[model samples]
Target: MLRALVFDFDGLIVDTETPLIEAYGDVYREHGVAFDRAEFERQIGHASFAFDPWRAFGAGADREALEQERRAINLARTERQPVLPGIRELIEAASAAGLRLGVASNSSHGWVEGHLRRLGLHGFFSAFGCKGDTPAPKPEPDIYRLVVNALGCRSVESVALEDSAAGVKAALRAGLWVVAIPNAATADHDHDGAHWTVPSAAEVSLPALRARFGG
Candidate 1:
């Protein structure tokens, strides 16, 4: 039986990833500098990525002020984002079916929880295994394992809903069935590692997922 469902936070639950990248791009644009979108994409689904987005502005640039501006832009854009399509319905259906719901993400617990709460979907989750909760994040299976354990279910008895290649690898490594639903920002990512790929969360249904995964 499918005892649990674990979700990835940023791109999957909310489109925070796109807004964040756009915020950085906006800052770069204001300074008449070009933004390397492909470079920023490297940090999409994992934590502790080594990237220096401000190097293009040269040594004389005010890093602190620029970061502040970028953050403000990001916050404004992020606040306007709604829960991704069909995510709310999928969560509701999974909940009504008595399946445990949880989140496993590379982001900090505060980040994930804050967004979920803002979207009015926080109460549906029972466990959250985020950054600092485990030794490592997605691509390591640490976060996924932590959440599955917290949900009191084996990895095989759970399904992982993800939006990135790294997240798919993590869930697959943890032995859970993975469904990849890439967002606009992640649409170009290679998600061949996932068990299945859907255009959007709207294509997902609890019954169909369980049937596909033998839950």
Candidate 2:
């Protein structure tokens, strides 16, 4: 039975990836350097992909200042975005269905929790497994294992909602049924690995999912 539902935070819960990439692109524009969007997109949903944004800057560039600027832009842009369509409905449906709700992410707990709180969604999830909670992040099963165990759920009894290829990979590795719903930033990713692929969260139905996977 599907006893739990786990969600990926960034692009899944909110479209933070779009604003994040835009922010970096803005910083690069200010410095007259072209941003490598494809390269940065590759880092989405990945915990430890080695790529530096400042490598394009001059030798004397103040990396710290650039980081601050990027953060500010990202925050400002992110603050303007509303919760994605159908996410609230899904959460409400899962809650009413008596399934444990959790978050599994490659992001830090503080980052995930803070955004959830700001979005008035922090109270919804019963468990969270983030970067420091495990030795590895998405594309590995560590964080997913931590969250499912925390929720007292067997991997096969849980379903994961993910927006990235790496997130799908992690959930599958952890043995959970996964639904891939691509957001603007992750729409180009290969999500064929997921058990189901939907254009948006609006298409997900609790009864349908339970009927298909809960048994």
Candidate 3:
């Protein structure tokens, strides 16, 4: 029986992908390098830190400088970030159904918290686990394991809602069932091992989730 629902913060819970992509593109333009959206998605989606396109452009970019630039752009964009459609309703429904809620994402705690606060959804989660909270980020089971443990639920009694292949792998590796909601940025990625790959979280009814986990 599923006792908890874990979520990925960025693309899954909110529509932050477009803003992130725009930010990266803006930063790249400063250095006279065009940012390739597809390439950026492929690389940065799998890494904890933002990729430095200037370095890839052979500009001898310093990692710290790129990080600073990325941070400034991200913060500016985040101020206007909005939650995904039906996200609040789904969260409220899940909460009303008595499902424990948690957040596990590759983003830093500050980034996740800022977004959540902006959307006024910060209080819905019982626990928030971020990249720095765990020994490693997504594709690693540590963060998912931490959430299940914090929720006081068995791994088998928990379900993780993710939008990326890496997030699915991490949740599954942690012994929880996974429901994938692939976003535009990661829709082309393979989710062959996911228990289900839905178009959006709005389509994931509470009954369907419970049924999948035999709760």
| Model 2 lDDT, full chain set | 0.90
lDDT of 3 at 12: 88
Arranged by TM-score with the best first, the candidates are 1, 2, 3
Q: After superposition, how far is residue 39 of candidate 1 from its true place, in Å?
A: 2.0
Error of 3 at 82 (Å): 1.6
Clashing pairs in 2: none
Point out the worst 10-residue segment of candidate 2 by lDDT: 44-53
TM-score of each: 0.96, 0.96, 0.89
lDDT per residue, candidate 3, 1-215, as tens digits? 77899988878888677677778888788878776888767643454445545566565667678768877887677677667766788788889999999999888898788778878888889988886888788889999999999999888988898888888888989998988888888787777688988998778888877777775
Residue 123 CA displacement from its true place in model 1, Å: 1.0
Off by over 4 Å in 2: none
- After superposition, the stretches of candidate 1 with alpha carbons farther than 4 Å from their true spots are none
Report the C-alpha lDDT of model 1 over 31-147, residue by residue, as the tens digit. 999999987877789785577779999999999999999989999999999998999999999999899999999988888899899889999999999888887777899889999
